[model samples]
Target: MPNPKIFDLTPPDLSDYIAYPILIVSHDAGGASVLAAWVERHLDVGQCDFLLEGPALRYFSGLKIEDSQRHSRTSLVPSEVSRFACVITSTSGEDVSLEREYIQQCRLLAVKVLSMLDHWVNYVPRFCIDGRLCWPDLLMVNDVYAQQLLVAIPGAPPSLLFDNYYLQQQVAQVLQYRKSSALESTQILSRRILYVSEPSTDSRYNEFELLERFLNSIFNYDYFNTQQLQVRVRLHPREKLGKYDELMFHTFSEYSINYCKNELYHSLAWSNTVVGAQTTPMVIALYAGIEVYSCLPEVVEKMTLPFDKIRRIY
Candidate 1:
């Protein structure tokens, strides 16, 4: 671990001495969102090349890239990448190997690689490929808590604290939506709950199991039975469309159960309460002044979200 570098309001000037175009790469949804926000806020779209796959392709859509294509780790040519000024990537999940492979290849080619981490968990494991730690030249995180976590890890790469422009934008969008919408008063009067689901990558519980527990807990409360409660579950981008079909069949009779059909802000605006384990959408909901709850089971060691405003339901 080294002393963390903190950047000010603006992103680092990557194009200062660059002679070639910058290459941006991402795979997972979380990382893709962060990288897409960074590129939109800081970089010149025309001068960058993008190699987006998975959910990243969706996030980076509508951007004007010099060359944007999906390529696997094996298809990434050394000679082609060596021509770039540098590589900027997002740290993806363990299952994804493209970012780690890019880091190794970039290192071998002496190309400066900067990797941005999207979430707070799995700091060390993100860079571990084939039992070897593939440290980038610099790792970027959004906040002080993430910076501290990375610094605590043994042999962690140097990290930079950059502003989370994505979250800021989301907050702004929520505020703008609330001001323009006429149904804000009525929405607050109703008991609309939104459960944002995430893949249980670091937890012992899966989405279905946790959601069942949540449903059971709410059902026991007498107030929920009397009130007109509307419940909707928003699945993670990685989750399949019909992943919660079985759960819906069993719980539909108890309450008006449905899947979240709208976008993030739209869903938040319609809900007065949002629940999740440690997903990022819950954070957005909190920023929008919605009631948030952590529904992690008792079997889990502890809650990972660092926000004190989020109350624990279990």
Candidate 2:
């Protein structure tokens, strides 16, 4: 059996994150949206800003949180700081590697670290990682991959094998409507998603082409239930020079795929079904118990058994 995942207690009440505004930097494709949505839900009072490297500015800003999600008191973090934090936060075009001394310097200056659950540790070099296990601050990551998070802080509250509270909360919400009678009333329309994409120069495989081929092949096949399907293409975000756009098309799809109402896990959970290749959205769809049909049959065969035994493994 695999070892139990570890969780960490972040020093929440530190003077570093005191009265000053918090610049939450999110660098991955939909990572900013996830962070912003979470803050809007849980820490509405914190003065927050979204930092962007130049190319990514247009894309993340395009998916910015609406004012409706903002509470009455939260202030918009200024642009200068946003850019400054973004540059300091951003590492390189291919990977987001934070310099240990640089991050420590930011810590000394009281810049609070704001990052997605997956990329949070990349922000800090001091966190511990031992092959299968990587401890980012107090957050418990299952493996060196750093794909998942705990719902509760270690020693603070008991949590399930999966730790994301928002995920837990959202699961609870969707599950409440799971009964037979409940299913009858709810018109669960599954949208056909076009995880539209290109390939990046850095990646070994052009994920965009692979995913596109996947979608083109299986979307019309009878294997997947299409009762609620409405297919659409993913639109890439606008770009700027000098910054690493999450949408940078050395490759698309995973890099800058359009996430409509059909996608899951990035932000704005999709009610529709996923139609694409292997990626983050696929993982999230399985978690949501939503319908998933893969273009890659071989990948599906290998991944399905482990997914079925996810709970038992932990």
Candidate 3:
């Protein structure tokens, strides 16, 4: 159970609006991670039913929920949604329209809907589907930064602050890993960097191009030997395999490059430095006390990440 006093701004009690047998929906990994952490911390496992798709299914798989169901984009029907008192969904960047569809259905049925925002960018576009806005009754955010962003939007739904239990849990894991390894200092002779990759949505440069620029800039530095520098590219859950293979082969062929196959904590533990363009893992790496860098190359867009510790290498 979550301690209510932890937050300076207390959100309304779930019991006030949410009834038993609540439905939780998420399609992307980022939203799924937030919703899953909230569920583990706040909700009773017996009273929640999860409707998950894509990477969300993987995130919720470890939960001991008996009523969880995995569905394709179109398989879940509107009739099934009427059974729940309220619907909770995570805003997704993917092209899937199921979340908007659910919000539409919930609106017609007069059931309350709560939507959670996982990232800072794309505040309004996430709820817009097919030129129609499917605004929820209430919006939830984990940080003041996200809440401020939501509140700035004209006629945006009421936003509430909640603890980012997912990030908190990850930070704890990273700290424990550090303590167990007894790693007081990073190895100076060899440098291990984990490049966390995300699909380029709003960036002027594509993911591959940005990565290429990052590699080129770092390689030009005269201090480190090429053999001693290792890079492991960790792909986003939405990204497909072999997405960066061509770039790895042709552009950064001389460097030691490989895909990260380990879990997130293990991968972070293996590296002294982490790089990405406004991805959540980079924030996690920053919290873990790893040297973090943002690789935005010639992009005119302002950096969305609110952390000052993340050095902009571009």
Candidate 4:
């Protein structure tokens, strides 16, 4: 489905197309963030009439369900949705079979399912972000972002996409950073560090083991022991792992974590590293200049990386 490269935007290109309320879907929080930013810009450029996005597609990495639900603009379906983008995207959880089924229902009503949004198509989206006057079939992006995307969809091309990793990353970052009113005293990634996991292989608990170990290693500073330290851990959104009273690890794999805090580029900058298995975070971390480590031991040794630096992947 790869098309010859075309660099210029033409009027004839968009004449037959209509934004027709887009519904964005994905397990990637960062992917949602990119869409939000793109939509706002697209609206400003008068691209589509109105883009209708679902709840999970717009959520940031961190936050409580209650807080996110309270925002009317962010809510997926309040009362009416004329047209939307239905993205059946996710890396960890099995594809939302229900959401995929709903795609046709929404499309029958005029919503569009944008399958390709290769963020790494040509270049990183400069916040000088502009609107997509015409919906992109194979949205061109940068090689950097493209590298990250390959992890999520191995065969995926930088210009050819099946999901939005940008929004997913955004949601993850927001959820990781946002503090709910619950005031639960749990220490989280305060340092310039990154938490990594390999969802394509290990189970949720296995990731938890490494996460707890990582946290204990970092939090138990000069004066603290593992027991004395309080850590904030954002588990893989794909891992609806069991509850963690034993550790302050936040389980976000089951339900989408709430919160739309910042753009993917900005938040990624804060993390010292990007951790994942066959997931896209590693590529993103590299693009954002954050170090990346593959938690999936099996793949770590086999995959090629641009930099010599490699993760344990175990």
Q: Which candidate achieves the best TM-score against the true structure?
A: 3
The parts of candidate 4 lying over 4 Å away from their true place are: 1-16, 20-30, 44-93, 105-112, 116-192, 196-206, 209-232, 237-274, 278-281, 299-314
Best by lDDT: 3
Query: How high is the CA lDDT of each candidate model?
Result: 0.79, 0.37, 0.80, 0.38
Q: Which ranking of candidates, highest lDDT first? A: 3, 1, 4, 2
Clashes of 3: 0
**What tens digits encode model 3's per-residue C-alpha lDDT throughout 215-270?**
87778663335557888999998888789998887777877899997788878877
Which of 3 and 4 is the better model by TM-score? 3
Which residue runs does candidate 3 get wrong by more than 4 Å? 1-13, 67-75, 182-186, 221-227
Per-residue CA lDDT of candidate 4, range 58-170, in tens?
45323222332232334544223443342222211233232233333444465433332333322222111133122222332324335354335433322332244454554
Q: 1-314, model 2: which lDDT tens digit per residue? A: 23235335332432333233444444444343344344455443234444444333433453444453232112433323422332122222234422222334344444433234423222233222222222222222223334232332232222112244444544555445444234424436444443433234323345544554554443434334553444444433322231223333333333223334232332213334554334444445556676654444343333322244122100
CA-RMSD of model 4: 11.5
Give the TM-score comparing model 3 with the true structure, all chains together.
0.90
Greater-TM-score candidate between 1 and 3: 3
| Candidate 2: residue 87 Cα off by (Å) | 13
